[model samples]
Target: MQSTAKAGPSHESVVTNGNGNGGAKSTPPTQRTALILYGSETGNAADLAAELASLTTRLHFRTTCQDLDSVSLRDLLKPTLIIFVVSTTGQGEFPQNARLFWRRLCSSALKAASLRKVRFVSFGLGDSSYPRYNVAHRMLCARMLQLGAGEVFERGEGNEQHPEGHSAGFREWIVGLREKIMQSFPLAEGVTPIADDVFLEPEWKLELATTDGTNGVMEGNVLPLRVANGHKSEPSSAAFSSKLDGTTGVVPNEDILPVKGAFTARLLSNKRLTAPDHFQDVRLLDLQLEEPYDYYPGAVAVVYPKNFPADVQDFIDLMKWQNFADKPLNVISTASKQLSPSPLRHLDLTHTHLTLRWLLENVLDIMSIPRRSFFASLAHFVGTATEDEAYQRERLLELANPELIDELWDYTTRPKRTILEVMMDFTMLKIPFEYVLTVLPMIKGRQFSIASGGAQRLDEGGSSMRVELLVAIADPPSPIIKYRRRYGVCTRYISSLQPGQQITIGLQPGYLDVKAEEMSVPILMIGPGTGVAPMRSMIHQRLAWARSMGLRTAGKRLEGDVLLFGCRSESADYFFKDEWHDLVEREGLTVWTAFSRPQTSTNAGVAGATDGDRTATRKQYVQDKIHEHASRVHEMLVKQNGKVYVCGSSGNMPKSVREAIADVFVECGASMAREQAEAYVDVMERDGRYKQETW
Candidate 1:
């Protein structure tokens, strides 16, 4: 049996017993139905939800996976089992894809009896370093319970920063979830669940077809080019352009473009932002767009970077696929009935002919940390003759077991080992190409806040615009075997680019939700380290507007515009120092800087001093500076109705800043209790007077 209805903003439908392939017949409904819904900003939760749906299907239940926003209250009420996989984003806020659903759920009209028949379980993906870890899923579970939904099991929290990695907690939770399901709803007679096999059944099958001259090549399709000595053909200019346009025909330079997807841009320059002797390596990159693109001050530029050539070659060597590296191949699902829905299903596979090398480099994320299932899958391919293979298979199975999670963490995550390294280490385990494709994670782009102002242009004609980015090259805490230095995939790829080199990119609207062009009141921006990127954009824009209006400070002190910036040392990492001074002089901008490490000249040598330095002047943090100017900040936020913007590390910076602001309300003789002061900040957030962009 199958049923369909418009569920969410994407207009996606919930389906049961229906394969994803068109024209495939639906299976009869099972005794019970389950719904696996997810809200994901980065697709992690969605992937988990899909996996759970497949598992439930094997258990003889009619299961459907859909985004939370797509399903209404009425739809949610029907499911006997509802599994929620959600990720928390931006200071206890729901993912953008789930915001509308969350708002509707929060409506007072939905009483306790609305979801009385529903039985639910929740799995949250979060970073434990944040103050409001797993807040989104926690809120959802609480609200559902209040609406009379029965809990199938305790809510599971998957910590990305966990010592054993998020998969450790997830694997443990799934074991418990399976037990709960079995107890709650026994399988019907004559129905048997699939065994926990080591080898994954092929969801997708590989097929090869000889290119016929009659069919014209599809746009963006990777067609094999004939080359001498059986070499692969270079990517044609048309193919490059088509890849930039993605599935959507609209060019990136158009005024209105999709918030996410691939686009093309040229590297104009890559200049070092910090001194050579500095411990941190920061680069100032300038990318030239094809044409003037309309973007707000706080917008972000997403770069779709490829794997390092060396790493890609390493993977190819390990797979022993040099012979088939350039061979044309097509992928299609083996079963007519799709076990789970996949974005890859939409691709016209008949027209696509991708090479093995291209798939490894452009399609899969080989460098990602492997989940527990990955190890278990590899064990299936291990040869049992050699003691090493036998030991490895046993060890891998143990690692997959949730009870030995710490050992798994030590072996893989703590050392920051990549999947490629793990495969190389297990010399006897040779995984099939099709299995590898099914298991590997998809490559995603890295997003950076655009640092340039909206008024700035690369050239006089404005046909091409220039945008700046500040990137800090990542260096692992300690070097691993075989690798000299560890670099973030995207940052390293960007750093390797030369002037005039073209790169594929995309644009994503800023999540700060503050519009600089619509501002009518004073703004206070707090940014530390590289967090100054978006703040710089906003400051430049405001200064440009002030210049056009001929505005200036009438007195000794500036009013309205304020920026609080923090960094390690004034000489080493003070970004745009001269620009800030110019803005203060020309546009009446107020600026405050907190240097966590200050350089002081001494007889011994020029030494770096911190807050502990007694003889030398003390170093200060931005939070401390805010505490010092409590009254002034209170006046700006409460009395003057000014907006507060924070951009920085997700760890403790955001929480510290909020605490500092709350203290201002209490210390300013307002007679407000601490709880009330905190609530005041919550009100500011809800009113859109306070915004934050943190990673």
Candidate 2:
């Protein structure tokens, strides 16, 4: 018998049942297929989905993983085991990648019983600090249930503030998920559970080819490729020839190239936006792109930073791998396990031969705070022969224990220490190279808001290119080590870069949901500090719009644009001060300034404030300003139907601003009670009139 299985929404593969004959065969039945879909903004949900796919594949199930946006509504009607890994973004909104899917799911045309035959499960990544924590996943589960889908297991919510971290909670949830899957789908005859001892199985084989002393010709014929299971093979040239003029050294094969999601960019300029004497260091950076990229006003630029050379060298010296650091080591899977459906397939290092130094410098995040599992793994390497080793081992084990999690946080997280420092402090533990790969997290990029308007002319030829960013240097106050100041990995690296220095950056879009046509409505922008990045872009865009429409300014008394900006003091940290003045004078834009720390008489004309600006004497905050203008704000919202946009610190600013807006409704007689006023504000958020991007 023959059966068709769906590997993904866009993929289908054929599976044969027993032998092609009617007679009973000794082969076990084909594994049931499973679908894993994810919606992610910062790639956390996608990472968790990939891990779940890997785990399920090892447990004798055919698995396929894809983004939720790729799955159509028709795919939801299929009778399959589906798992959703999704994350909530600002204000409990669905991630940009998942918006289309969510809209389709909420369609009125779809019947309530459309997915009655489907069985599904879900997991959410969220931060408990937010008011609408995990609302995205909760909404997803509710909609799925409304469509008559049967949930096989309880939905899992992974909180970032959890004692064991989101990853540990996800790991625990997967165990229960596997058991539920087994009970829901019975195994075929003669099928057996996989052994717990089997940790890794390889799918592809790699072999090193020697280069001849002459041209690029090899001494012997290239080895024939080994095909695993029934996987198809791509044809390749038997004799490799040099594409270069043969003057330069051998070029590495495409397989050994850096992993995807990386783009090389050159630094064009770096200018400090804040005064030299200011407490904070804010900078404006211009990056020259090697290739053309497109982004909107509020999109982010993710910069993949490298560890400091000194730090990398320190880690290598601590590992005592100086001799073997540059050695070419070929990796192949152990021959004991079956090669079909490869395990460890997600790791690129398994398919190529690379130096240990390259992996340490580019692959692993050795400076990040070590997780609980890392401590547990480190405990195994601590020798019990000496008294120090015994005590350290016991302590490491305690730190790894779930019961003593608070102590673990105090020792590792509170001090903001890195794994290298922990290893140096331990003194007796020596982790092996093989175990290092398993414990360390992958080094990822740091995201910053794109501060400039997209696509600027790079030359006289009118070739529009380059992107700009606003980055604030983060120098932690308390030193992790005595006399050694700790800097933010990405920010410090970018700050240290000189003009014409090359770096890798990637564009992340969809942060701004507003379209160009939506600029007709009145906009109220409230942003403080570097949060003004996106607001600046919006202001420039509005200026262009006004020029196009032949209007002198963006908005009038109640119909145009208004911006509320705040900082410590105008003179020291007044970002884009000249530009704001030009915009207010030429474009008829309305602006309000709040200086939190106004200068006193003794400190007049210092960094805090100057005599020219009278507003600096009041010492007011942005939230206080909002409350002071409650009547005008109410008029803009209720009488003019204006939109509100807030960008700034996530800690108390957003909550404070939200409460201040709610107070406006009550003071303006729009609502009788405070709860009703808050409800009105919530309604405005639901209608997309109130938007925020804070972090």
TM-score for each of the candidates: 0.80, 0.74
Top model number, TM-score = 1
Which pairs clash (backbone N, Cα, C closer than 3 Å) in model 2?
A: 555-560
* Cα lDDT for residue 109, candidate 2: 92
Q: Per-residue lDDT of 1-695 in model 1, one digit per residue for the tens?
A: 01111122110112234221101122233435678989987768876886687567555556768888878887786666789999987657788678889999999998887877788899998876555678888999999999988888899988876655466678789988988777666654554564443233444533343554222333223222223234433421122322232222321111111123455677789988888899988898888887557776677887766665456667878878766665565555544345445445322233333556666666577877676656755665665677987887777778766678777777777777778888887876666675556567766667788888746635456677777888887756633455534557677666666677777667666767555443567888999988899999887776555555545434322356678888887778888877776666654667777778866623111121112122324588889879877877888888988888888776678888989999998998469999999999888887877877777
lDDT of each candidate versus the true structure? 0.67, 0.65
lDDT of model 2 at position 593: 66
Cα RMSDs, all models:
8.7, 9.6
* Clash totals in order: 2, 1
For candidate 2, what's the RMSD? 9.6
lDDT, model 2: 0.65
Q: What is candidate 2's lDDT per residue for 592-657, written digit by digit as tens?
A: 767788654333221211122332466777888788777778888878888888887766777888
